[model samples]
Target: MILVPGLWLWRDPWLQWAAGCAGAIRAAGSQPVWFGYSRRVAWTAFLRPTGGTAAELVRRFLALYDRVRARHGPPSVIAHSFGTYLVTRALSDFEGARLRALILFGSIVSETFDWGTIVARGQVTPARMRNEVGAHAAIVRLAAALRRFGYPYGESGVTGFQLDELSRSVNVRYTGPWLADSALARYCRGVWVPLLRPTHPPRRSVLTLRSRELSRT
Candidate 1:
């Protein structure tokens, strides 16, 4: 699994949280790769009049993905905040980029991102895509508000993905402060570990069961 962290992480405790998540993934019997920028990315970078920095980051992420895929095959990804936007753009705008699964938290990707297209193209498994939404994520809400001023941000981490009912992307909502350590630990152990470990049924069987459950609702 590849772990991508958000901007200004060097100044915040989330980097430690990310490290804990990596430890959890390692404990779950999977390799965890941490993809970080060479320098600190400040929150002000997002307000740039042009998308130069964002585009460069996407390019770098795709390079990392290619290298990892060539060495260890496709990898599952866990991204937060701007990392989510970077991953989403890499998968959506580029071809031949593959992932086994994706888990996003504090996502800033547009709510209307075309996830179904990526699933249809076999870039990411449909049943394995998850968006962890935080009900009290004020930062994501602020990002959504900034979208009106031409910022490329969204409230998907707050409102979740606005995809169709049949879409395989799962939006798991949690209620709490965004940076609560206890909540993060719980999610890493209880939610993300299961997603990465594959202790459940095969993808097709899981999809079939999900379809049946949806039919009943």
Candidate 2:
């Protein structure tokens, strides 16, 4: 399994989490390969993804994937945050059986990602976000933002925007928060009163990037 970390992190927890997950996979009779990437990134990049940024990340992961295959044969992958997104893009065009399972945790990917194309080559993205974070009001707020941008967001069993394809081998599980559908998620949700909402409208220029994102399929 390859352990990928989220934005702005490439070490420590990524390595530590890999150790723990590797232990588990070993216990189950598997060899795990933890792939690591950029250790740092400008925080502002999240708000404004540079053109080709995603493609570049995918290219890096593809290079690592090739190295992993040559050294350890096809192995299952486990990625978190941006790592998951990177892996997804890396394998989307892959046509070989050099991969086994794909387990994503806290994946920050759009729902419309081409899962079907990748699954045909044999790997699946987990669609268990909403269930796992339903109780965390903070996550709900985040998911809402994801939804506003047409990204996959909310509810257990929710496959927000992936292609209309299914994989029997796919394993989707909600392992935390589970707040999107919870009463607490609803109650503590921010900006309940419209009057309490931001008084000043955001600058029109600020909406340009977001508008482009939403306008895309």
Indicate the residue-level lDDT of 114 in model 1. Answer: 81
Local accuracy of candidate 2 as per-residue lDDT tens digits, 1-217: 4555555433465343455555545554445565554444422323434436555666666777778767655555656555555565566556653454454545555655666666555553333112112122343346437566654433212343343444332434444332222332232122111211223443556589888888995
Root-mean-square deviation of Cα positions for candidate 1 versus the true structure, in angstroms:
9.9
Candidate 1: misplaced stretches above 4 Å?
A: 38-45, 175-183, 198-217
Candidate 1: what lDDT?
Answer: 0.75
| Candidate 1 vs. true structure, TM-score | 0.81
Please report, in order, the local distance difference test score of every candidate based on alpha carbons.
0.75, 0.46
The ten-residue window of minimal lDDT in model 1 covers 40-49
By TM-score, who's the top model here? 1
